[model samples]
Target chain A: MNAMLDAAWAVFVRELRLALRRPAEATQPLVFYCVLALLFPLGLAAQDVGLRAFAPAIVWVSALLAALLGIERLFRADVDDGTLEQWLLADVPFPMLVGAKLAAQWLLIAAPLIVAAPLIALALNLQPQAIGVLLLGLLFGTPVLVFSGGFAAALTVGAPRAGLLIPILVLPMMCPALIFGAGAVRAAQVGLSVEGPLYFLAAMMVLSLTLLPWAAAGALRNALE
Target chain B: MSGLSKRQKRMAAVLVLVLGVGGAAFLGFTAFSKNMMYFYTPSDLLAGAAKEGATLQLGGLVEKGSLRREDGLKIVFVMADCEKQMPVRYEGILPDLFREGQGVVATGKLGIDPVTGERTFVASQILAKHDENYMPPQVAASLKTADGKHSCAPFKSLGRPAENLAGKPMTAAAEAPRS
Candidate 1:
């Protein structure tokens, strides 16, 4: 068990190091998220009330797109360097290694988005309670998004034009997360019980956590073959 | 055969796949259907399809000559989707773009009139087309005729009355003194 954990840790560190080396790649999505969030107010010319009403949808959609911007490269670097096949051959389990890599990707790509969420929410004129719920929704929803995107990324690692394929394959699967995430904020805005959508988002996170890494590992093996 | 039969291993994998995918789909579908709403026309509401007090969006053209101000900041108007009309009551200032014959979407609950028991939409928010060239997509789609042509029938019969300028009609464009 210790050996498996150590191996997972090693993979996590290695992936994080690689990401840190490419500062531009790591920061591009965050920049995209901020720019997109700012564009809504200017483009729509919405009043404070209208901005408040649509803030949840704006934030959630921008986050989803920003996450997508980085996900196509999740497995590409490892696959190109042949590190993926080495991991498969190592004594540590493949799924554990995959899970570790996904964790690192989530931290790099989605965690900052969560931290910056308040600024975006405030800029869009969201209420304090609604901002809290929006944060919670992102807390649960972003992981599911990363996992789903990672699975799709793993599947297409060996395919040509993976950049084009990833969004087409992943966007449909992401609809439920988007709906529930935005719905939670809207519910809180209207003083409705946010637990319903938040619970659904939590359930999605659980489902993704259990299933995606194994599926991604299987896809990696297929790609390596 | 090996310790575990190959067929048995395949069966186990298939079982897990089915349970996982099926369960997730079931949960996702139920949550989505429960929360997502399609914009309903007045005819749909009039047919009693919408349950009383259920929160949803209603889309139509604002009926001409039907807008009336009851009290300070309380306005009532009839909305028609060409086939039928429903009365809507809203409190607070309407959007600048809100006007007769323009497309609008009112989000609120369908309430029963206390005395008449007729269904009326009590709007919590009134959203009109943002500009002259832009129409809310749902409102535009709701107004499309069966033959795929855009129909302005809802506004055609209700002739364009004199522009209501600050709650009064301006008799002629030239009558106003140059600013």
Candidate 2:
């Protein structure tokens, strides 16, 4: 009821507060995303035409990789400090609490990546209209990344040195999102209708947001046991 | 609404979310079903799937002897699906992999031949279809008849020209024959 929502709100607030406490952690993936995108213009000798041609792919790949950067730490700190056990014992539904934490991660991690993407895409010479489609693609695509990555993070929360394991486990599952996300931008850049890829991405985000929180909660229980 | 139990409210929210997403996906799928074809075959164009003057991708095998390279970069070729064939005219430096009897996809508009009043696909850009192992022309021709499997043949080792020349419009100087 109201109590569950209040508890979920409290957990979300706490997660955001913790992220603010370590501001570098929140900004690190964004910096990684920007740097990866910025490197393409320097490395490629071609002028604006070549850079613009590759802009959508570069921006999408960098965003996908950057999303992975913060996912490993998604549940690690709570597991380390025994806060996960407290969450399990709380009266609110455990999945709701996990969803709230993931929402916070999406805000702190994926949101920044999306916000910073247009700037990076512009640097790569992507057109303004294409940049709008790029933004929309990331808006729908990144939540799926966060939720799916959070599930992988949850699965590996108890594993020692699980840094590289999360991306390896989740990247294959996240391929469709990457394809549709990048395809939308490419279609827009080439003056094709972007609705198809954007719809697929939106469907994926809805399905992920609906289902992954419970899946992650189940994985957390397995790790706890 | 305020008196509803929390469980009922949760169900309502979940129902709304699912229905909303499902409706949007359904609408988009229906609206874009025509545009989403990877590339339209000659049969598709002949059947009137695309309107005249609208840009689209035309894909098929280049007929074995139908290639005519005019002066400069202008080339005319017959692109064939299993059921029908269409003539495509393009003015560009053909990709390195461009060859007769290989699969190709051209992006451009469908126009009418002014003299003959016949349909012509005027391509702005031409790309060689890239596949790992191409079937020979005979096998591809037979396969196209039997099961309608269009395989790119004879052009090996070339990456997709689409990727190489994406968003790079070539110079189209009205080189297509008027007749």
Docking class of 1: incorrect
lDDT of 2 by residue, A19-73 (tens): 8998887799889999999999999885856788778889988888888886777
Instruction: Tell me the deviation in Å of residue A63 in model 2.
Output: 0.7
Worst 10 residues of 2 chain B by lDDT: B169-178
Chain B TM-score for the candidates in order: 0.53, 0.62
Write model 1 residue lDDT over B100-155, tens digit each, in one string. 76678899989965545777899999988432334667766664433222232322
- Relative to the real complex, the DockQ score for model 2 comes to 0.12
In model 1, state the lDDT of residue A185.
88
Best by TM-score: 2
Model 2 chain A worst lDDT window (10 residues): A187-196
Predicted candidate 2 versus true structure: per-residue lDDT over B1-179, tens digit per residue = 23457687678668856875676567555435424456777766777666676667888778767898888988888887544689888898788878876678899989986545778999998898865645678755554432223343222111222234332211222212212
